[model samples]
Target: MNRNLTSQQKNAVLLSMAQLIAAEKAVIIKANKIDVESYRGEDIAMYDRLKVDEEKIEGMILSLQQLIADVDPVGKDLFHFTHENGLKITNKSAPFGTVLIIYESRPDVTVEAAGIAFKSGNKILLKGGKESLNSNLKIVNLWHKALIENNISTNWVEYLNYNRAKIQVFLENPTQKVDLIVPRGGEKLIAFVKQHATCPVIVSGRGNNFIYVDIEANLNLALKVILNAKTAKISACNAVDKVIINSNLIAKETFIKKLINKLLKFNVEILGDVELSAFENVSSFDSDEIWFKEFLDYKIVIGTVNSSEEAIAKINKYGGGHSAVIITKNDKTANTFMESVDSAAVYQNASTRFTDGGEFGLGGELAISTDKLHHRGPMGLQHLVTNKWYIYGDGQIR
Candidate 1:
């Protein structure tokens, strides 16, 4: 809990961390395999998260390298001006000083957050989930080794090694040593942090994305987008959880039939209205509950909308404010949907699955935030830093 590192020492620690990850790629993969084997008999959700093979390790390495290549987010002047009274004001980026990141399941977040904090010049304390404890420990050990190699204080990247009680103590530690608390986990974890922690909390809430297929949308394009969005990976936060189609298009039956065939082939269950009941593959469900649900699976809830306004209303009412997409050929319709829908990331002619930090070209994201305040959408290195003002004057006191 000590903040003793100078800015120069912090940067050096991060540089060495990047070098270590690149050099010891095989070590990371080996550690991940230990976790994967331990969770072999667990549920699918836990197993998928615990399993990290060579591909995932490669992705982590590439993301870390990209972060290393990007310009340092700290120390840039955002604004500068001088008043007539000779008061000089300059707003510039500065580290949050110390950050505490509490996340779950995803071992990759360890590397992602560490790299960003290193580049932005902040000391970080990480508390990863127990499910992936083995993987997290391995990664954190390498980071500490890197710090020693570069002659930097290992305190810059401290990992909380205790259990739940210790985590709670760290969050409510009131020492105020931790400036920001970022929780990248489920709703319960985020809610507990938000309600209990005195430190500023960045809530990266769960994602419930939606996609609307307008009447003017080409049938072929809609099918491709829907398939890619839902079937790509149902477990991800950005995957399509709900789909709304224009009533007019449903009457045509051509698009609905094609969509149903593809979805069934992938074992995706469809819950739709009476209008869609004619499709043999779909099952009818009450419209109310389905609209508000975020099915983090291959199951999708379908609703028929009267117009673009209705589609927007449904999305606003049901969405988790993470990501929403509209498929349409009309520019005016697409623009209207984009402006009216209130979400962190809105898309046109694309799948909601593309709402990732790497896809947006920020190397990778710490998390996809549903919170509108402070950090929104895909968070990168810049989001980890805050701004401070520096004032200079020649003995001119107001």
Candidate 2:
């Protein structure tokens, strides 16, 4: 539905949704409580993401309001030129037609993700998991209300409640035209979508993120960053799942011991590579497959690297290509690590947690794309568009 909406019309829908969310906060929370109550999973991360409290509702409203203040993502000129035959040609931003977002356990995605697609002038179809079915339904109803209030087509926002089998069928033969598909969930869910979907699928939501503590890293800073990255929000895709330490760092054992003590407070399970086998409360990775796993739980792996080269190679081999951080005081080391590490976002002396769209100053994100095509990192409003070429000719022939 790239029907050429004026900027005012788009912002109106977002503002209306914000107001609707504010007015329906209690009802929304009530519905979310049902979802939370029905959730019987053992995964703490999934449980955490399933809950929608008052603060989370406020955050949803804030995301919509923030999106309303952003400029229109479409129709901006990327390039313009006069052809040799005197034809005026212009290349400008355009919508991706319809965007289908498949997510699990997050009702706010029903708001923020849909808002980005609508504001970009693309229709959005939401496929939320059964865990958040009640919550997602309520929020999508609010979306329909906002569209009606703005005199827009309610079809612009649709909620698809399909089982895994149904979803697989739909992906293979979508009932409607699907320009882009974004699967925002764990590795299994992403793999499911990529395996079945015929359309272009942007890989999002997996994070086997890493933080390398260089030999020159300040122990205090490394501890602080690692703790925040690993425990601040265990469910986030940007959360740190691995910590690689420089083998020759001063007092390396002491640092690991201190790190273990801090992590114990959060009750995080620590796994170590063969080099780190001696630490207490730290177990060895049962298999090499653990290196490729994105542990969305209170679990982490700590490995030792002899040099930055080893760390880079290790990360490139097993990392999710989502986010990687290097903690060091050396500028040259930071630069080389940042450039050589193949992640969507590279950090120096900062937590991997800041890979988020809001933190990166893009306002809000639809998803954190690990794929290199079209976009990478947090997919905000500006990244939701494609480009089209327009030409005006006056009887010109080659």
Candidate 3:
């Protein structure tokens, strides 16, 4: 922990990492292709996450570059004060010492999350899903090369190629110092980590996000926002999985028809609760189980609420607490909805897709946290640290 590198040294490593990625683009793509080819389409969400292409590679490079450009997150003095007893106390941000990120698919996380941890002065332990082993190994190798080029230790970013049994054992009794564990996949994954981890676990919980359309909502705006939120990236945690429309909405039937037709354009499978199940082209939800599902697919559920209070209650009951949106022109209604919804990110007249860290202007994120301990939103470069207090005294003691 005492081996701290200067900002210039860290930036050099990041620059080298970017250059290495650009130079080895073809190799990385080849590895990703092997994983993509192995896909049998058994799990659509996993398949989507595992596949990495040109754009994802560019995104990885950009994440590294962004971290290099941002201010050094460590060593910032948070508070400094002196006691009347001639004692000085200083509080400053410090690295978590080590951060373990366990994720499924998403090979880009190997670069982006590791980059964030590295820039924040935390030694990152990356345990990626086995499906992306080929790609992850290659990327971690590049990171090590960059660190070596900058005369830094490769321990800053270590990759753990462990099977499920090994991972469970490590979590239960780690030989290493695991300061924090972030599980960034499905509910089962998050639950597993939480069950076994001896250290604090930051849950990157699933996004069963919801959007409520009030009576005063602009139909056009609602359509646009919902379409983008659902179709833009069906696999994203920020994608809208369910919608609650006001029963008193003006031309409610017409709006429902429009929503159904638009979703049909993207082949989105529509399911509705009892309130909307009678409508044409909408199927009834299979039990209340649908309410708790994080549909990271081309599927969505539509329900109805008679009042804003009802909408808020329904969301708080079933939503994942990741993000919630309200499409209402009335400022008062929007404020009430935003304030009442218990979510990490609340939106008014906007898409839930903006819940992403990069989209939220954080450059990149380790994950979108639903936990309210250290953080509740995107775990970005700045959110990755804890703090330390330094007390100084010459002849004073407490």
TM-score on alpha carbons, each prediction: 0.93, 0.98, 0.98
lDDT of 1 by residue, 303-383 (tens): 788999999998998888989999999989999999999999999999888888888988888777787767898888878
- Give lDDT tens digits, candidate 2, residues 1-398: 43888999999999999999999999999999999999988988888888999888888988888888888889999998997789999999999999999998989889889999999989999999999999999999999999889888899999999999999999999999999999999888999999999999998957999999999998999999999999999999899999999999999999999999999999999999897768889898779889899988899999999999999999999999999999999999999999999999999999999998888877789999999998999999999999999999989888
RMSD of 1: 2.4
Worst 10 residues of 3 by lDDT: 1-10
Candidate 3 matches the true fold with a TM-score of: 0.98
The local distance difference test score of model 3 is 0.92
How much is the lDDT of residue 204 in candidate 3?
96
Candidate 1 segments whose C-alpha is farther than 4 A from its true place: 1-15, 40-43, 174-176
The superposed Cα distance between candidate 1 and the true structure at residue 29, in angstroms, equals: 2.9
RMSD of each: 2.4, 1.1, 1.0
In model 2, what are the clashing residue pairs, if there are any?
Answer: none
* Candidate 3: regions farther than 4 A off: none
Alpha-carbon error at 374 in model 1, in Å?
A: 1.2
